[model samples]
Target: MRWSSWVLFAAGIATGANAASLTQVTENFGPNPRNVGFYIYVPDKLAVNPPILVNPHWCHGNAQVCYTGSQFATLASQYGFIVIYPDSPNTADKCWDVSSNATLKHDAAR
Candidate 1:
């Protein structure tokens, strides 16, 4: 099947009982201290409360670079789920600070 048709089929399977529109929203988790920006996909018709999928970029990778918000967005729209792609706090390498205490605390809070 074509890619478009596949997407439609998947969407139909996702919203088998209830269907809703799709939306993409950008949000910054830590605007004051750490700038952890993320993109969230919200579906319009949710039969039950949607589940969230957190996607973290690779080392030296930015959120925009890692998650293009295309395939995942389409899946979220069809399946009634929320997708979150978080940007790294470090600007130099654009990598998450897995060893830093401060970064750990900030991430835990978020």
Candidate 2:
């Protein structure tokens, strides 16, 4: 999808971010050239420069939903860290781009 389309989609999801103690944030890393967007879950309270966890989704799945369903969020809340869920370049599959080095680099570099 185009960058503008992704921005719209990200904005749509971000509407509900402030609903609770756990806030969800959307960030676009398209400037890196692959047009990747990510969802980050941050606890209402955090320590100084908390650590981060990068969670990737499986094929044709949702990364934020997965992270939300896992124990990671709970741990992050308790431990005061950040959890990031990056969307695949191909959202259709939602799979980590393990196809090639360049693809993998794109995923890692973001």
Candidate 3:
């Protein structure tokens, strides 16, 4: 799937329930040239090969803000799925690098 599409999918889930705190993952999953922060919310109970939800925060926001301010984590807990919060590498404004060529390309040097 495209990188930009996950935002819409995450917005469609139900909200307003309490969830566990987000966990920061230091393990390198791939070539993170931009050094984006990876935070995940894995429920106490997980389904078999459960689906994942990538929840990115808005401008001036980070993974912690997105995780605590949204219902994706709560939904993940209730529905047995995983929620991944990808933080922007940009430290100034904290917005994603949507204008970059690498970001526009799929399976690029991520």
Candidate 4:
């Protein structure tokens, strides 16, 4: 649950965002991935020509208002780049061969 802990720590940051839409997109990149939990937010304006970015761990979906992400997201768009945040899978710790984090459960792809 380290990722969730970090998300909780950064909860204060994504409080006052300027964007309009947040989306959780899931695509079957390959037949091998039954569920590749990933998430992204496209600013309200990027409904059509928005950019796509690849970053890890920004929003934990528990934050009511993502204050920390607002400015950074805005800046990324200002620089002609769209920002993307990836949700860590329940198996992030698997690389260490450690016990699973029971709380690290994923909901259906929204």
Question: TM-scores of all models?
Answer: 0.58, 0.63, 0.75, 0.39
Residues 1-110, candidate 2: write the lDDT tens digits.
Answer: 66445434443444355521333444542454665656666665555766767787778877666776688778877887766676677856767666666766744543
For candidate 4, lDDT tens digit of each residue in 1-110?
36343332222122226343344444333331234354444444433443445555433332113424456566654554455555444454412212344324443232
lDDT against the true structure, per candidate, is: 0.55, 0.61, 0.71, 0.41
Q: Which of 1 and 3 is the better model by lDDT?
A: 3
Tens digit of lDDT per residue, candidate 3, span 41-84?
A: 77767677768888999999999998889988789878988788
**Candidate 4 has which clashing residue pairs, if any?**
13-67, 13-68, 14-65, 14-66, 14-67, 14-68, 15-66, 15-67, 16-67
Q: What TM-score does model 4 achieve against the real structure?
A: 0.39
User: Which candidate has the highest lDDT of all?
Assistant: 3
Q: Mark the 10 consecutive residues where model 1 has the least summed lDDT.
A: 21-30
lDDT of 1 by residue, 9-91 (tens): 44444344333323223322223356566444445654365666667889887666655634766776678675556677677
Residue-pair clashes per candidate: 2, 1, 1, 9
What TM-score quantifies how close candidate 2 is to the native fold?
0.63
